[model samples]
Target: MADVETLHAIADAAASLQVLIQDAIEWKRQHLTDDLLSALIAAEDEGDALTADEMGEQVALLYLAGHETTVNLVGNAVLALLRHPDQLELLRRDPGLDAVAMEEFLRFDSPVQMSRRITLDELTLGDKTIEPGAFVVLGLASSNRDPRHFGPSADRLDLGRVDAGDHLSFGGGHHYCLGAALAKLEGQTAVGRLARRFERIELAGEPVYNGRINLRGLASLPLAVG
Candidate 1:
């Protein structure tokens, strides 16, 4: 159950995003090119696949899924490395470790924590039996930290962990995130350059979270850099 304040916060945030989505669509209309927005626009103009209203809907989902979520991915990566200096130093010492470290960061604290799924058929797993049409909330973070696949040190951050890249952060199967590769590459570049560029990056104050339910991320990450 959500309190009035929480409901209001969500409503406010959604409204702001809708404004941004409209702005993006308008911008893309003025400057059509061979890009994502143009591609979506073509779907409506050429193929007649998406209605004008649904064009807005698809833009909202893509922007939220692609751009908004990546913000958290980088933020989460930096925070994780800060909490584990040894891990941060590993990247600082070896730029090659950036890619590997990003994987561990995703596993350590997945940017998006939960995914919603409807059971297609009856299924039994462990001790619980879920009936068909059951709505299940998959915990990406929980599965990433499972000891069964990640070993006893699953709870700890290990940049060199053999299976660290095999996380559920981008989901799996046909529903797998199309932007997973780009997201990982961006995370590697951002966190890597940040560590190498700064002589010192230390926490200046407590971090504040954005309070989004599905896309877990920091609203502000205070730091002192030299």
Candidate 2:
């Protein structure tokens, strides 16, 4: 997931992350003879067939997706709260709103904006017929803001929004994000602590966006905090 093409960030940071991915495969290869994972699989008779590429992909998926999702979610959530003081106050006054606020944060400004899938069968969605085998892109962020499910305040930020949990930010079904739980927990912790800890948080300067469509996030949140 640290593919340079997908993650357009500081080159140095990107290089360092890429190195981590490469090291994971090398580390596995170096300790293959004594690796606990291999030993466990062998004990279960599953065979030692996981290839280096597969291992790298898994590492990449776990490292990048999990980390980036929470990073973006926390940053975006904080920025959103800063912009909406009413919601920020609610979060600060009530610790119970931490989990619920995370959902709205994910919905209001999704960290991962889009998800792709191949149609299994010809289907009509909003009068557009998509054939089987067709490449389809689902706009998770757009769906999250749809007035249909979220009512007229869909476009607005509502910490206690009833249907915020129905958001597609974490995707859906079997292909849903594996790091969804981790991301939520991290987001809740980060956002909750910030609201409770800081007396004031406001945008100090212009916010910097990563300018990415898929994994969109704030590159930097220039803030005035107290």
Using TM-score, give the best candidate's number: 1
Clashes of each: 0, 0
Candidate 1 versus the native: TM-score? 0.88
lDDT of 2 by residue, 10-95 (tens): 66666676688777555654566765444533443454565555555556667777887789999999889888999999999999
TM-score quality measure for candidate 2 = 0.83
The true-structure Cα RMSD of candidate 1 reads 2.4
lDDT of 1 by residue, 87-155 (tens): 888889999888888889899888889888999999999999999999999999899999998989999
Q: Which stretches of candidate 2 lie over 4 Å from their true place?
A: 1-19, 22-45
